[model samples]
Target: MFVEVGPDDFSQQALYDRLCETDRASQSGAVVTFTGRVRDYNAQGHIEGIELEYYPGMTEAALQQLLKQAQQRFALTNAGIVHRVGRLANHAQIVWVGTCAAHRNDAFNAASYLMDMLKQSVPIWKKEWANGEAEWVAAKTTDSQAAMRWLQETDEPGA
Candidate 1:
């Protein structure tokens, strides 16, 4: 597992390469990766950029815990996540999550789970600058609904 929360920019390819190296024993047959980017347009319209904020220590801890859960539930051999904190321009990459597993299903599901969970429970906040106005973003109902499926899954026996 590798997790990073910081201001510095990252190379998506570099991180993917690192995740590929995570499985040293040739145990992983599939790898899946995801990168989230700040959109130029959002619900409010004409978004120029976003300011990401997070409580550094607390945010990192929460992210790590989420990753651990994904690893265990998906039987992933390895995973990596990096979340950016600070100002980001339109089209800037905001987050990266990757997983390595022996099967395609496990890697794909783990990556999907990581992104879904991070969207809801993580302490990070987004302040969007759009139409020359800046506002703190409100949590979306869809995001909450998406994350809820995992909770329901965990409630099922041996799930």
Candidate 2:
């Protein structure tokens, strides 16, 4: 498992290459990845950019925990995450989550779960700049619902 919380930009290809080079990568039959990018628009209006901030040590710990949970909940050979902090222009990558498993289902599910939980579980904060004004982004109910859905699904016997 690899988890990084920083302000530096990362190459998606580099991350993929690293994931594929793991010692147990050969055992993986499927690799799933999710890349989140800042959009030029949102529900409010035109978004020029965003500034992300997080409690350094705490943020890393929370991310590591999420990765560990995903690993335990899924049959994953390896998993990784790279989340950026600080100002980012529209269309810039914000986060990347990748999972490798022996089957497509596991890899896909693990990647999805990580993203859903990451939105709510992490301590990162976002200040959105739109319409020439900066405003702190509030947590959306949909994000909470999505995270809760995963928790509920995992409790079901067949889910």
Candidate 3:
């Protein structure tokens, strides 16, 4: 498992290439990826840009823990996550998760789990800037619900 958090521009192609390389090394047959982008509007209506803040060391550790958990919960060969911070415009990539596994189901589930963990556990904050005002964005209940589903008794416990 690999996890990175930085302010560099997000690149889907680069992430895909890295995941493919990992798959080749592990002889995995399937890869799954998910990318999240900033939308033009939030629940508050219009938004121009977003500024993301995170606790450097803690954020990276939390992300690595999520990846490790995903790998243990699913039959994954490799997992990678990259999340961008700083100022970002609408439509820009915000985050990405990639997973490789021997089967499609494992890859899909791992990718989904990575996203769910990121949304719920990662200590990153976002502030929206629009109309010359900036405000902190609240965490969504839907994201918490999604993360809780993976923690149910029926779900496999992660490392």
Task: Give me the runs in candidate 1 sitting further than 4 Å from their true place.
Answer: 154-159
How many residue pairs of model 3 clash at the backbone? 0
Reference-based TM-score of each model: 0.93, 0.94, 0.94
Clashing pairs in 2: none
TM-score of 3: 0.94
Number of clashes recorded per candidate: 0, 0, 0
lDDT of each: 0.87, 0.90, 0.87
Model with the higher lDDT, candidate 2 or 3: 2
Question: How many clashes in candidate 1?
Answer: 0
Residue-level lDDT of model 2, residues 70-152, one tens digit each, is: 88888678999999999999999999999998888889989999999999999999999987788999999999999999988
Structural RMSD, model 2: 1.7
TM-score quality measure for candidate 1: 0.93
Cα lDDT tens digits for candidate 1, 70-130? 8888888899999998999998899999999888988888888899999998899999997
Off by over 4 Å in 2: 23-26, 155-159
Report lDDT (Cα) of residue 108, candidate 2: 93
